[model samples]
Target: MTETPFKISIPDEKIALLRQKLELTTFPDELEDSGWEYGVPLSDVQRLVARWANGYDWKKHESQLNSELPQFTRDIDAEGHGTLSIHYVHKKSEIAAALPLLFIHGWPGSFLEARKLLPLVTKGSDNFPAFHFVAMSIPGYGFSQSPRTKGFDLAQYAEVANKLMLALGYTEYVTQGGDWGFPITCRIAQIYGGKHSKAWHTNMPIGEAPKSTTEPSLTEKEKAGLERTSWFHRFGGGYLRQQSTQPQTLGYSLSDSPAGLLAWIYEKLVNWSDSYQWEDDEVLTWLSIYWFSRGGPTASLRIYFEAGNHSLGAAFSVPEPRPTIPLGLSQFPKDILVYPKNWTREMGNVVFDADHESGGHFAAYERPEYLADDLRKMFGKGGPAFGVVSGHSGYA
Candidate 1:
């Protein structure tokens, strides 16, 4: 691994240009019925744009981000294949005793996905100083060089992320992810189980979907959960279809305009945020991370071109289970798709499965206090850390 000479300083000119573009954005005329049907709600977006154009302060958010986290880039050259460049930030916490925790964000989510809640996960006052926080931007997202090719599925991402962790000199660490982060963490646990992979955790894991054959009998509560899951896929999967088939076209629209990018992302923010009334300060704080990194477009579309290509239909196999390593599952209520405890039990040791009373798909973002504390307990117990655990198990 080579050190990539890089910094998180976004030039003043770029910030000014972004604001200018936001100010100049012209909304396309749409019928009342057409509002938000095609994408983000026109009226809601206008409100957000108005605030972004006139009230959002990028420099303030910039200063806060720089002070809270130190950002840098590293290049990992895989044997003879090539080098992959990544951007990462480590929160400056005084607790050297904190367990090493690696956080991975999902599609349309930059490293800043944890921005509002980093302190909750790493600081002392909330509960405990439990983790040495390491946050990273996925390739082609934010400062990290976007993947030059397609097929950057969870397995591929896990490979690169593990390399990145090794490059950072963390022999053992605990990993937590949501959305794409969940699948990526799963691959790491599967491929690098035991001493090399250690223990890992996830919030929104994509486990094997229920088979379509004759209805396997489900308990009453299980049946309710399945019904809810089915409803979400039927109603909300339109976005997935577009993401899988025509990401390039979607990329063109999102990448071209600051307003377009903000609306595209803000939908998830508002919908998934535990706090439904997303304040201006909170909303722009996140948008600024993308705007400064100019990651809004590249990261959003990468998932479409990368994971959409394959792995969606691959048969679900218990990721080469490692008996020695422990796995933690922190399931949140509002998550659209969830893996039952029985499903995760097949892959590895289930140390902890806590179904929280609150929060949604973005657990870390929505309930960092709960997420971080749970992770702290898992790490402090010393069962396993990261995807790599101690000792050779069959999984590794």
Candidate 2:
């Protein structure tokens, strides 16, 4: 398979249609007392919709994306499962000089989420080191094509990620991830770490696998993580359940109305991220990606549905033996929850674990410098130090 070259440019018709949809949206009437219980406040949606219809500029975002990062497409051979095209953005750095680090994003996020790290990782920031960065959208999430089969779970994601490395000619590299990215990275290390696989790392690792019969013993932190997970199942799980069962019904509203899509995606940004202050430009930039592709609903829900059905037998059957590969973690206060270092020590060789005073789930987007510095110390030549970045380059 050969590399595919393309650029992002939204067509005039799509923009016009989006404007029409924004103008003619049949808004839902809300009760004064409902507040945020019925999802994003109707008032907030109206404000965002008005701005999206009149003020947001697709051209500006397109220009910024083209200028800041180089986007490319290549067909990654998914083991024996034929070939699939994947989209990726690599900072313009020397191949040999930069450290090859792949950043995988989580649910409700695309490759665009990882774009913030270009500056800090490529050019050492005040708190971090310079390393070559590569960010890819998960399959069915952004520009990447959806899996041909029904169940493209985390393990398959890891397998396909390895193929992506080979397709791009990466021998071994470090990885950084949170949420779904963390689990995917864990699977990568488990399968390919030490002798068999390449060295890898993850920040937010999952220690407690969902038990079917007996509840597993829980630490205080694990208990909190479980609560967060349960809370998600209670409140936010509707989206997951809908996606897993009948995604088509919801897709219609999201795919047809730009306002609907914006509300759906933007609400998550407001709640999940700690950097709402940094949201104005970033939010619109991400919306442009989904708006242009008309992939708002299909891609958004498909990943959740895929994860819901993913078989865990393979993941648990072969546990990861403690590998000597250096692992690092950054625990943030506002983050839903994270495992204790002792839990992670059972999986791989953990060298660094720091409890950050601030930041949240979207640390890379919200607190790039903090996360970057930790990454620099872990992967770069710089040893443990307060906010010192190493000068490294080249992403294989």
Task: TM-score for candidate 1, please give it.
Answer: 0.83
Each candidate: what lDDT? 0.66, 0.66
Q: Write the per-residue lDDT of candidate 1 for residues 1-396, one digit (tens) a residue.
A: 665544466777877888788889999766778754566678877887888878877777777777766777888654333676778877645655555567888766778777755776666533333456778787667777666655666667777788877777666666788777766777777776664566778776445644657645655655555665685677656667676667777777776687887887787776554555667677776766666654456555656555635334331234444435677877775676755556545556777777776777777767777887777556544433322333211110
Candidate 1 achieves a global lDDT of 0.66
What is the lDDT, from 0 to 100, of the residue 358 in candidate 2?
68
Which regions of candidate 2 fall more than 4 Å away from where they truly are? 79-81, 92-95, 124-129, 195-197, 209-234, 294-296, 308-324, 339-347, 382-396
